[model samples]
Target chain A: MNEHVKPVELRKAFRLVNHGPTVLLSARNGSVDNVMAVAWCCGLDIDPPKLTVVVDTIAHTRSLIESSGVFVVQVPTVAQLELTREVGSRTLYKEPDKLRNSGVSICEMAGHDLPFVEGCSAWLACRLISEPHIQDAYDLFIAEVIAAWADDRVFRDGHWHFETAGPEWRSLHHVAGGHFYAIGEAFPADSNGG
Target chain B: MNEHVKPVELRKAFRLVNHGPTVLLSARNGSVDNVMAVAWCCGLDIDPPKLTVVVDTIAHTRSLIESSGVFVVQVPTVAQLELTREVGSRTLYKEPDKLRNSGVSICEMAGHDLPFVEGCSAWLACRLISEPHIQDAYDLFIAEVIAAWADDRVFRDGHWHFETAGPEWRSLHHVAGGHFYAIGEAFPADSNGG
Candidate 1:
């Protein structure tokens, strides 16, 4: 299902990842594009919306993200499980157009250069922030989120509304091996009436 | 529930956090002890199980952790929601025994000086890695996971078993504004059964 991209304020961008959903890292270099699943990622900063994600030095997505200096982190839902596994294991080095081969549809945002997986609940377009030590030592890339968007069905008005959505709309959280857990039940803090 | 504290290979300690559950940061300094909920944390390295967690520099727990060089990250389940909120908001700087005031019980493991939250599904004891730049600039502390434990009811054989447990046993994933989602349903990768 197609969804409109809703703009998220930079300061509140950390909320996009605060819940800790597994994301698909998408990057492109000219005609070549790639997507890979990454469970290791967290919100590093709030004001500028910085995030840190681990990308193995050997992965093809690393070079593409480095060369383009832009990448998208897409928060996928339960319905996209097959696609997540497909893109995660199939390296782009062997098959240049892995997305097409994996049968995962993609749509490129007009303003942002990166393409987002069509079924993801939210997407964040980010520019790499150079930190030589962490990159070399931990295979981690710290980036400033340049633009952010979310599917209104699951997220709206600065909060996630997973309660009203279908099971397929719940975001995925990866555990060890290939196991994943879908997000279930939204309970707002009593302190915040909203 | 009492569970065995197994020593996870330092390299594999990152697996404990791969899924992105909000953790309770527990620290103690002499007679003063504190606990705070943190939604922002990520694995920084695998070999030594280094992790980056944001602890407000001004927080009482930060001072205790910095001085003692030890802290524990407890992955609380949905049943502990009330305790999570209580510990997160009640600062030790004001209420010296916030842990006791919150009505949450803690148990000490042999050979380790730190205490673990009794009801948590998983626990990780860590030692500071001493990254002053990130610690000062972002209030982020990088630490190595020295010990790890999990309640077999929810996690076993190196994977989360949320599908078999009740809602209360599922791990908590904080979305924003005190809203949380319980970890749900498991899907293992067909390619690698593990």
Candidate 2:
């Protein structure tokens, strides 16, 4: 693990994804590790932070999550645009070398035995909270973020410093197809308003 | 309705929120109308487009959604930062004049009876898909977008033109508190890679 990869306080874990960036979902069932890009992830709660991510039935990563009951949601950066597109478009089901073909390098955290992508700005180690109804009906999976980490270079003090970070460090938000927009300028509202 | 407000095809309605921008959710029950800011809305399914939003139990708008069973999810622009913060932080339960105090102007679509917020870039009139389990446990509400519209100036032909649109027209992605990031530069992935 990189020195900058530090554990994010579980309470502030929602901040990792509060901005709504396209995330790379990675999981390991046993010997198999798979990763895929997901744009439907959203923050669900604050304390003991929880989130929801939609995984299609076709995604190989979803099966790993179903079996292992754990997964990692990591935010990819603008520098990984091609990598994000590659992993998102190719399925491990058909392509045996999906991870290698997508140019993804699997890394590990200190305590969790989940697959975390190498260069993402932030990661949330999530334990699947099974809700079969929505999972079967909507393909939406809800999970509690048991542990979280972020590259302190971009996120620290419970906030994202995208304004000061280099352009490549900015998070990617997918619009459609291969089209995406990097998170933009900080616009802070008047403190008195809120 | 502004002449620029045009209908979005149901299949492409997910595009309105695909990039995960903070949205203003409005609901109407009889003569009562309420609008609240939501940072948790996300695209769920494409065909007969569905979405999920987390409205805390304390929100006065949640009751309106419960009674009406329909609400509007509209994308807030960088221009509405203060308005978003106001509605998001203040509740109608305490401040009966929440909408007016937040500087929110309620508008309506031609066919739908739901309340819509003005000066937003896109709007999706949604019919709540009753899911009592998640709603009570997670404060998550699932809805099917029945009617959708976008300001053609910023969104047209099923894509966002944030790179070309004015800075104020860009979608707002909330970080925490009143802090936000407007959608930024277009980062299209290589077609060959995907």
TM-score of chain A of each: 0.93, 0.96
Clashes of each: 0, 0
| The 10-residue segment with the lowest total lDDT in model 1 chain B | B185-194
DockQ of each: 0.53, 0.61
Model 1 per-residue lDDT tens digits across residues A34-116: 88999887888788888888899889999998899999998988888878878888987888778888767878788777767
TM-score of chain B of 1: 0.91
Model 2: pairs clashing at backbone N, Cα or C within 3 Å: none
For residue B91, model 1's alpha carbon misses the true position, in angstroms, by 0.8
lDDT (C-alpha) at residue B102 in model 1: 82
| lDDT (Cα, tens digit) per residue for candidate 1, span B1-194 | 36444555556667777889899999878876778899987776777677888887767889989889999998887788888888878887788678888867978888888867888888889999887876786677778888888777776677667778777877778877678877776677663212
The C-alpha local distance difference test score for the whole of candidate 2 amounts to 0.90
In terms of docking quality, model 1 is medium
**What is the model-wide C-alpha lDDT for candidate 1?**
0.81
DockQ score for model 2? 0.61
> A99, model 2: CA deviation in Å?
0.7
Candidate 2 C-alpha lDDT tens digits along B94-191: 88898999999988777788888999999999999999999999999999999899999999998888888888898889998788988888876553
